[model samples]
Target: MMHVLYWSGRAGSLAPLCLLIECGVPHETVQVDTSRHAHKTADYLRDVHPLGTVPALRLPDGQVILESGAMVLHLAELAPSLAPAAGSADRAMFLNWVAYGAGSLYPAYQRVYHTDHIVPDEAARPAAREAAVVALDRCWDVVEAALEAGRPGLFGDRPGAADVYLAMLALWHPAPERLAAACPKVRAMKDAVWALPSMRQALAVHGLETA
Candidate 1:
């Protein structure tokens, strides 16, 4: 059995947890409450994840996999319908957008959430957050355009791991209402992913069911 380390609220673990539910794969969810700094504990760092992050996957063989994006891709392998086949024409596109979400958008949000850490000067922290928000809007524009071109989801017409990944990121936007207004297509895509029963269950677990 696989074990997913997670926490309540909108964390990166939401996507993989949703996929695990969608795939109907047996797994256990272990909450690492960040509010209490459980993730930074010595035991977690030594046994679960050296980086001390949630969304770490403990495979059946006891090896742990970190990084939510990597978990999404790996979980998709267990349920092929969630992603394009390994060498299919859509495979490249799928990988491209997933990387974009993980590499680009994820970091952009981190900049906003951790502006004080990124900007040493107290006076510059707000500016850093504003810049991050701008970058996030630009990222959404790219996704919105792609969705407008009739690609309902990153993996084709149906909501898949990539779609779930993007949706989770979308919720992290500083201004979700403004984001939805500016990127209607992205909103639609998020709605599509949210419509999935498994996704709803996962989101509810994360206390984001109304989001």
Candidate 2:
């Protein structure tokens, strides 16, 4: 069976977990409690994730896949319903938004959550977080416009991995209500994803069922 190394409440793990459930694949979840520094352990770092992070996928063959975006894509391959058909018209748009969520939005949230890592100076950390928030808002603006124009889902009428990925990131916003108010389309997408049984199961495990 495959294994997903997870840390509850960590946003990075949300999309992959949801996809795994959506795919109905045989998988196990191994919690690497950040509060106990389990993710920083040498064994976990060497074997599970070189970066010592949660949401790494240990395939049945023992090949570990890091990066949640990669995990989502890989899992989607196992169950194509989670994504647009490869080379289809919507495929490019699907890939684009998935990359945007993983590359642009994820990093922006990391900047806000780990500002000290970027700005070493204590006095500058707050400013760094503020800047990250602005950048995050801009990223959301792009998503909002896309959602408003696109189908109910990020790429189609069906909620796919890209929609799940975006919803996972949206929940991490520093001020979710403010973001929702500013981007109703984004909110609608999130609400749609949230209603999925697979997503509800994943969210319950991550303690985000009420989110």
Candidate 3:
């Protein structure tokens, strides 16, 4: 059994908990609230992670693992049934999608968050919001097409790392209404992935279960 150090309500940490649920292993979720700045303490820095980010998984051997990308992928590997098998091309594709979500999509989402929610200047809100909306639209376009491309749920058989990550993105995205209107395929993917039992448990706990 593994123990996970996490902040359940946080955007980044939520998917990791979803991964844990999908993994179907006996693990414990140690709540770390970022809103209260609990992850910034020295004890957590030394004990949980140097960066003190939530969603760090503690190994049974006492090793602490950090970073959202690495955490989910590691859990995916450990719970191979949750993710895809690391055999050949499918493995590489899975990694690509996973990395793409963390790297490109996350950055793009950050821009949207900064422009939409975090920014304080009311005068510049429209321009910034438009810019962020454009970035988000571009990102979703790719995802929408990918969801429509040949495979239904990130892959043929089941939802893999890509599907899971993308589903969370769709769930946490700022402009879900716009996405539903613009990218029905991605909306379809979101519906399919969230329908999984793992996603249900994770999202349901946080009141994110609604369509």
Candidate 4:
């Protein structure tokens, strides 16, 4: 069994939680609410994550894994049907898109959601938001181009950890309608993933509606 620290409404935490649900792994969740400053507490920071972030997973062996990307990847490995097997031809491409979601798109979203943290100055917040919007849109453009280059989903027909992660990120976009209109393939991918019974169940667990 795994224990995860997360806040249900947050995008950063959703990816791993969905993965665990899809994998049918038994796990417990510890809610860390930013509104209550639970994540910033000294004990939580010291004992769970030094960076005070959510979506940190404590494995059965007591090793804590930080970052949703790493958590989902690790969970996928535990249930190979959730992802491609190691050394498979699709593995490299799978890893690449997953890394892109974590490394590129997620940070842009953080900037959009927490502009104050990026620039503490009150007057500069708007500028930060504008920059975040631009950055996020650019990230989506890259993703749209990638999907257009080949088949649906990051690794073709199968929905891997990367596809799940990307779909969750898309849910966080400020204008979901605009996102769907601009990124048809990403929208298709999201719908396809959500069509899975496991994904629908996962969304139910999170109090979200199916796509």
**Best of the candidates, TM-score:** 1
Model 1 regions more than 4 Å off: 149-151
lDDT value, residue 169 of candidate 4: 88
Model 4: residues with Cα > 4 Å off, grouped in runs: 1-5, 148-152
Q: What number of backbone clashes does candidate 1 have, counting pairs of residues 3 or more apart or in separate chains?
A: 0
Q: lDDT of model 3 at residue 204?
A: 74
Which tens-of-lDDT digit does each residue in 76-179 have in candidate 4?
88778767667987787778878898899988998998898879799989988988988898999888887743455777576778888898888889988988
| Candidate lDDT values, in order | 0.85, 0.83, 0.75, 0.80
Query: What TM-score does model 2 achieve against the real structure?
Result: 0.94
Off by over 4 Å in 2: 3-5, 149-151
Residues 89-196, candidate 1, lDDT per residue (tens digit)?
788888988999999999988888988888889998888789888988998999988775455676578898889999989988889999999998898888888888
The TM-scores, one per candidate, come to: 0.95, 0.94, 0.86, 0.88
Q: Which of candidates 1 and 3 reaches a greater TM-score?
A: 1
Instruction: Give the per-residue lDDT digits (tens) of candidate 2, residues 149-187.
Output: 445577667789989888888888999999999999998
Q: Which whole-number lDDT from 0 to 100 does residue 161 have in model 1?
A: 88
Between the candidate structures 3 and 4, which one is better when assessed by TM-score? Answer: 4
- Model 3, span 1-211: residue lDDT tens: 5665456574576677777777777778777767888889998898887986666878777887776877778788777666666687877878888888888888887877666566678898878877877887898888777665445477766676667777777776777888899988888777777777887888776666465
Model 3: residue 119 alpha-carbon error in angstroms:
8.4
Ranking by TM-score: 1, 2, 4, 3
Residue 89 accuracy (lDDT) in model 3: 80
